[model samples]
Target: MQLTIERIYTKTVDHDGYRILVDRHWPRGISKVNAALDDWAKAIAPTTELRQWFNHIKDRFPEFQTRYLQELEQNPETPAFVTEVAKQLQTTNVILLYGAKDQEHNQAVVLLQYLQRQPAIQALLRKE
Candidate 1:
């Protein structure tokens, strides 16, 4: 699947295939209409408890990534969500949008990596 991650604040464009806000909460200052989102995969995001514990601290990112991955593995919706994203990528680019200012240290980054590591997704990528 062709997947990418970007800040939700970035300007929308025609080429942002299936824009999905991967955040658990709506970003501040962005209107729903302006988001131009095809989906808001809140169920797949980190749990509120986990989010509060990490608090976006840079030093906590590694631990956060591990914890988030565990969360994803345990989350009942993740498999279905991943399948849906893969299906969408067959025809369009799937952008995983997030609100975090630190691009390298957000949940979206971890999620993207997790998606890429999946054998099914990797096979899909090889086909394209």
Candidate 2:
């Protein structure tokens, strides 16, 4: 599966495959029409409280990643999302779009890592 993470604010959109916005809140200054998204997987995003607590603080990134992974594990929508992504990967690339400025520390990064470790995704990767 070809999986990639991209900032929503980037001028160019990758139309090669499914573009999923993984943010709970709409990105500021961006309109829906311009997002070029196939799906907005808001259910997979961090809770409001967790987002607020993290606040993109670099110092808290380690803990934030731990908490975010825990949240994903407990989220009811995660299994479905993972299944959907795995299915999508069978045919095309999956672009995980996020609004975070920090490229390395956002929920999308965590989610991608989490998805990579899943058996379904791993099996899909082996086929390529």
Candidate 3:
């Protein structure tokens, strides 16, 4: 299933079946009620070390992906969880909400890329 990015401040979509947050740290100003997220996949977010290392640096993307993938591979639950989230997208659009100011380079983007690469995930997304 395709993963779309959305800002936390934006209105929640009625068709958005499952709104999943892919950020490690919660947004500074938003409250839980305002988030409107169905699932907070914090477990899949990058480790503190990786988060600190990347820090949204554009040139460090190659290094970031390498380290992020390492984290994903080690976390057995992440792949399955992401695959399931992809499946959920089939029935309803999954809004991958994130709080990062730099939209281009963020954990959500990396997480979205990994989810889209799954064969089963693509199939599920295609049906929708």
Candidate 4:
């Protein structure tokens, strides 16, 4: 099992799968109708405070990771939210779509790691 975040212009592979949008705000230029997204899982995205803090200074990635993890920890809804995505990943390739210019440091990267670490994701990987 694998998860990837791609820009709106990235080519879509021919596969049975789901593409989940991981951004809280609509991406600056992409229109909703043109996105062809399967679901918008905003719960996995960072809170507004976290986003603002990260965007405030690009030099604080490590700190952002810690704070984001903490924020996610207090959120009881994460497991179900992630599990919902995992269940879909099992049956199809999962693509996480994000709009951040700095794709490397955005919430999508954190979420990709978090989702991969899930026990369900581990089990699925072991089977492959």
Better of 1 and 4 by lDDT: 1
Task: Find the candidate with the highest lDDT and give its number.
Answer: 2
User: lDDT per model, in order?
Assistant: 0.90, 0.94, 0.79, 0.77
Clashes of each: 0, 0, 0, 0
Global fold similarity of model 1 (TM-score): 0.94
Q: How high is the lDDT of residue 36 in model 2?
A: 91
Backbone steric clashes in candidate 4, count? 0
Poorly placed runs, candidate 4 (over 4 Å): 9-16
Over 4 Å off, model 1: 12-14
Model 1 poorest 10 in a row by lDDT: 8-17
**How do the residues 15-104 of candidate 4 rate in per-residue lDDT, one tens digit apiece?**
446888888888776777778888887877889988987893668888888888887778887888778777877777788888877768
As for model 1, its CA RMSD to the true structure in angstroms is 1.3
Better by lDDT, candidate 3 or 2: 2
Q: Write the per-residue lDDT of candidate 3 for residues 4-95, one digit (tens) a residue.
A: 77767666543346888888789888898778778888888899999998988889988998899889989977867867686687677777
lDDT of 2 by residue, 1-128 (tens): 59889999999878898999999999999998999999999999999999999999999999999999999999999999999999999999999999999999899999999999999998987898
Model 3 error, position 75 (Å): 1.1
- With a 3 Å backbone cut-off (N, CA, C), the pairs that clash in candidate 2 are none
True-structure lDDT of candidate 3: 0.79
Residue 25 displacement in candidate 4 (angstroms): 0.5
How far is 21's C-alpha from truth in model 3 (Å)? 0.7
Candidate 1 per-residue lDDT, tens place, 26-128, comes to: 9999998888899999999999999999999999999999999999999999999889888888888889999999989999999999999877677778887
